[model samples]
Target: MQLSSFKSFPLNTLGRDFAVGDIHGMYSLLEKKLVAVNFNPQKDRLFSVGDLVNRGPESSRVMSFLGQPWFHAIKGNHEDIAIRSATDPDYMDLMLRIGGAWLMDKSPKEQARIRQTFTALPLAMEVQTPAGKIGLVHAECPLDSWDDMIFLLKAGKQDALHLEEKLCWSRRRFKDRDETLIQGLHALVVGHNVVEGMQIMGNTYYIETGAFLLDGEHGMTLLDLVALKPV
Candidate 1:
């Protein structure tokens, strides 16, 4: 399903652009947050660091938002797991345990459609704002070069396990690597690992505040790249 390792968005041309963390089926909270921020469905764009479904409620409904022009998402680990469970017979129970049982509630046709959509999601998106460039990832990116990682992903060189493991399931780099200088990257925003608040490492930022927990000062990072604050 033609996927690009990188996507470029002109954040300045749009009314505004915001990056959000994993949803895990918390559509109601997402909606409320957007409304609070006055997210304009017609002009504003919302990018999700992809774990859009699988834990809270209304997974299918959240998937429907993909059809909207305002919503864009990268492939998160949960989507990877759901795709594997749908295609590989052995992973169904594992999917359910990790919050994919919502898939079982849908019809076979619905399931196929969802799988097709999630499977085609891009692994990374690069936003070129007037301020600087921001890269979106579901989990931690490879420790070294963003360019090298982009090349591997753009070429689609990974096997199924590696694809899921590296792009979706990795956190070693985030924990173990030194915050060295990064090239061609103004900021990197990611989800997957829940953070108490935004954690800044080198040029990277982790904004996954566990919105599914349904409590506290949450709702991901609503960033306005010009000022780099929540807009």
Candidate 2:
């Protein structure tokens, strides 16, 4: 589908979900963890916090899955840079240094698939549940002043600003526990910074388990939103 067509789908109503952290191209590990938790793709929705590609061996596989009807994703910093590089000539080299090289190595068919998928991802997603609304982004929000995330999203403010740092690269939101809590969103789910395991600071959860086996770990963190449990 075309990029515009992809974005035209309804938002603000993704119900009963599983939000996953940065996959970083670890397709096999992702599959294992999904099966481990008995994930039902048809009935249970899967949403990615972004960074679905790069840093591992299967960018192609990652892109293909993200494009599936059952899967949804936000635009992490890696994806932001990639989209920019794909359209901007000057930034192409920088993008390659930060995992674009792996994407570039894929076959023509794979490359086309990846481009189509990434081009369709949103910068963030708002999931509405019976309890409350949850904001899913690649990195946490910085200002902590905006009470209405939906307004910001509609105002075209979701794109990373020059001083804001890319959402995927900012450490400010993760380091300050008090700041995050004060923001007052029911829950903020993010990936990008890998912790020893999943982290819970107030209602916010960070699930970036470093799925690429970066430190030789064997498991991928999985969050079951409907059941409110982690496996």
Which one is best on lDDT? Answer: 1
Off by over 4 Å in 1: 159-164, 215-219
lDDT of 2 by residue, 15-120 (tens): 4467777888888887877787677776667788888877787876777786577788877877767766666875578767656688667686766666666666
**lDDT scores in order:** 0.77, 0.66
Q: Best candidate per TM-score, number? A: 1
C-alpha lDDT of residue 45 in model 2? 73
Off by over 4 Å in 2: 1-16, 87-91, 106-113, 145-147, 159-166, 182-184, 214-219
> All candidates' TM-scores?
0.90, 0.79
Lowest summed lDDT over 10 consecutive residues: which window, candidate 2? 1-10
